[model samples]
Target: MAHLGQVELLTPELDATVWFFTEILGLTETARTASSVFLRTFDNYERTSVIVTRHHTSGLRRTTLRAASDEALHRRVAALEAAGRPGRWIDGVAGTGPTYLTADPDGHEIALYHQTEWYSAPAHLRPGLKNQPQAKPRQGIGVRRLDHVNYLAADVLPNVEFFEDTLGARPTEQIQLDSGKVSARWLTFTHKSYDIVYTEDRSGANGRLHHIAFATDTREDILRAADLCLDNDVHIETGPHKHAIQQTFFLYVYEPGGNRIELCNPLTRLILAPDWPLITWTEAERAKGQAWGLKTIDTFHTHGTPPLD
Candidate 1:
């Protein structure tokens, strides 16, 4: 696998969600249809990395990952078929070419694709720096790129195994309960500590989204994001603090449509060593709470998209 490509989030409050992403988060809206709007961050090379779709309930619709190569894409597809988890092919979806759509063990939609339309900024949006994709926006927080996605799964280990076996993702970190059950797992396809994560759903829900994160250039950017969230009446769910697991400086907030969104800065941590050991934390260790010892809020575990009644 290459890297995370795009994620489609379903939101009942479409206008408010789109407003929050474009105006508050500083994403550029590239296109809009009757039911969905495509958005991208300043540094994203692809045409779009997020799709906010109008739906009955707010949650994830699909998670797309770019393949390492055309050959790698076919290899994974063959592996999926051999494992009896075959997917259907989809073509001509706006910025992307052919896509193979499948589901994880918990039924979260997954899309795999190779061909993509690279973003070419028009005159107004062009960046002054030659290396950058588009000009950084003066409005809102201006996050750099889509960071990672977290999913709430009914069975975490099965999903973890599925990702590992099918996509060749490496487990970076995990949490194991006293019962010898893994409650959470973080996996990566690249050098970044975690590109995908699955945490046990306390509500026993399958296919629900935990949160989608966006990366900031610095810790100061996240702090500024917290301030912006407060000023704009966005619901602050948790931190402008550091996580004990990944050690990312983060801020969690609920968009208008009730989907959890995270703003984070990892501050130079990457899984550089190919033989990097998987770090596991016991239940007792996690109970002590976050990096600076702030007790993890109750909602951080139970709160997920398409909220339980």
Candidate 2:
């Protein structure tokens, strides 16, 4: 499984969104273009991420991440097609080395591709690279690298089939919740133990992001970062709790525009053996931290959680 490595957000307000990640949530500015700025958690986190694009409406209009090669990319696209899903590839997108466009439940576009060496940038953009003074004490927050992504779909079946058969990501867990006569099922995907996850929607925007998390070195750093968000009045969605798989204490903080950002520690262990069989989740396992009638199921287990459930 070639797991997800980073997530990029396209928003209208670049300055506001960047400030939220930098000052409030503590991310480092790795690279910046006239129209885009990328903040990373560390040099190795997601190869420089959290792209904020200047636009009119503030939301994730598009997203692009990594894949091993063009062959893998074609394999993924073919899988979606076989499952009776719609997907296409962009011949080439400037700034982003290469990419393919795919749509989710809310019709938001996702571009999956690999970047050229031009993207192997160092994360130390201090003392101001583009003629600006360096900001405050964020040595802990400088751009890390790509970690993983969590996406919400129209339904789980299409996404599960597309991801599993195409990209080689396998299910870490599956959730089914019953609310009166209606029941919902969601899927989790991992190159090893989930780099992307999707579930049913209960309200608000369709194709809206629930959250995207990056990994940290120590639980101390993660908790400290969460405190920074609270001090800055960034919304605290949830946090400082132990997950079933990764087992790391994590803090899920919402950015300036209500987009959830997770700052977490590395999983207790890494599933480095790519061929390791994907484990399934029991009913109680999937229901952890969930209630009936609530559509959200935390099937994801790679971002600072364990996998021995």
Candidate 3:
């Protein structure tokens, strides 16, 4: 089994974006370099869960997953090589060991690795509970850890094949168009319903990111985050509402660099059945809007970072 790990974000407004994450989003800075700064949520086990880097446009740069063991990492690499998508092994960066980098069919970069430096907070931030990563900070939204990420792919099926065949992710839910095509899909590698997601790009863009989500402890934390976004001049793109798909309580906002960020409570529901059947949503069912009645905003359908032509 492999777990969703660190995600690197490229942002044009590096300084302002970093401010938004550290000051308003309540993430802790773990390391920095000439081009990148690494950050982590209070409960992230890895030394750094997010990496903000200088770039001309704001969007996902690369996503990393941790293999369950060195043996697992080798197996995945060998499988990908046999599938004709041979990736290169790199020395890795500040918090991880050797990494194998490859891309999905849509050109989204992905890294698979086995070794990482577990986060060890300084004295003031050390948690009383040994199971915790760090003491919960009394600041910003105080998101727990990196959650799922949704990508906007020009076509969903090829990307889905990469996820399932190459990485061994199982689909938990999907949106089927009237034409009998899957327009969106959610896949999981853990008890949570989804670890990665792919949605049809209305703009027909390849490799654009829909959003990267951060989890909060409860629905109340998500509600409180909505207020925080308003108070801090952050743009609220969508709801403090439940999603019909995963029943996720979510709020979407744009950070300083224009990439969409979601504060959501997804851990409340667990997919425990080993043979959990796939949940398919028909086009008509999705047209009705969110779990309540909030229509999925129009921008959600067309807008993605590094805006497409």
Model 3 C-alpha lDDT per residue in residues 1-309, reported as the tens digit of each score: 477998999999999999989988799988799989999999988898899999989999899998999999999998899999858999876588999999999999999998999878899999999999899988988999899889999999999989899888999999999999999999998999899999999878788999999999888988888888898899999999999999999999999999999999998799999999999999999999999988999999988988764
Model 2, range 1-309, lDDT digits (tens) per residue?
A: 344544557565578778877765556666788988866543432345566767654445565646777777676667667766677667644345556678754565667776534433334544344333333345444323345565555455665655556666555545544432111222234433456666544442356565577766567777777677677777776666665544445677656544667776655555566455545445555555532223232433222110112
Off by over 4 Å in 2: 24-26, 30-35, 45-47, 55-58, 81-84, 91-95, 118-143, 178-192, 245-248, 272-309
Tens digits of per-residue lDDT, candidate 1, 211-270, equal 999999999998899989999999999898999999999999999999999999974899
Q: Locate the minimum summed-lDDT window of 10 residues in model 3.
A: 86-95
lDDT of each: 0.93, 0.56, 0.91
**Cand. 1 Cα-lDDT:** 0.93
Output the number of the lDDT-best candidate: 1
TM-score of each: 0.99, 0.72, 0.98
Ten-residue region with minimum lDDT total, candidate 2: 300-309
- Model 3 has an lDDT value of 0.91
Count clashing residue pairs in model 1. Answer: 0
